[model samples]
Target: MALTADSPLTELLQENPKAAEILMRFGMGCVGCALASGETIRQAAEGHGIPLPELLEALGIEE
Candidate 1:
């Protein structure tokens, strides 16, 4: 399944290992944290002050 802002971070990481690198590049090095399991991509990005659109682009998700 394609990733989206609402996708759980853990699910995204499990589905695409490359997503770890993308998250790290965006200064979100908490992939292994417990919260990742329940956190959505949008929540993480918003918490880190990351622009959702930029992150989506980096993840190769179409806007």
Candidate 2:
């Protein structure tokens, strides 16, 4: 499934482990944290001060 800004971090990781690598590349190495289960892509990006569009693009997710 295509990932979106609202996709839960845990779901993304489960769906595609590469997503964790992508997040880490973006300096968001929180994929293993408990919050990853509850946090959305948008929320994670915001919390990490990452630009949402950039994160989406890196993840190959359409805005």
Candidate 3:
């Protein structure tokens, strides 16, 4: 599935643990952190100054 700003990090990780690499690569190791448990991928990426499109690309998500 193509992830969006609405997709929670936890849910995505649950569906694919390998996705953790995507998060970590984007400097979002906080998917397991309390403050980011419910945060969306877009939100975390934005917070870390990472572009969402780049993140998706790192995760192998095609446009």
Candidate 4:
């Protein structure tokens, strides 16, 4: 499945394990956090003060 802002962190990782590296590079260490199970990519980005678009771009996720 394609990733989107609404994609849960766990789902994102399951679909694209390489996303972990990109997420970490962006200072999002939630890859191993329990909240990752429920947090959406957009939520994570907001919590980390990261611009959603930039993160999505880095993850190669279009919009």
Winner by TM-score: 4
> lDDT of each model, Cα atoms only?
0.88, 0.88, 0.77, 0.90
In the range 1-63, model 2's lDDT, one tens digit per residue, is: 777899889888888888888999999876898877899999999999999999998888887
lDDT of 3 at 47: 89
TM per candidate: 0.90, 0.90, 0.80, 0.92
Pitting candidate 1 against candidate 3, the one with the higher TM-score is 1
- Clash counts for all predictions: 0, 0, 0, 0
Best by lDDT: 4
Error of 2 at 14 (Å): 1.4
Across residues 1-63, which tens digit of lDDT does each residue of candidate 4 receive? 788999889989899999999999999876798877889999999999999999998988877
Collision pairs in model 2 = none
Query: Can you write out model 1's per-residue Cα lDDT over 1-63, one digit (the tens) per residue?
Result: 777888888888888899899999999988889887889999999999999999988987654
lDDT of candidate 3? 0.77
Task: Summing lDDT over every window of 10 consecutive residues in candidate 1, give the lowest-scoring window.
Answer: 54-63
Worst 10 residues of 2 by lDDT: 28-37
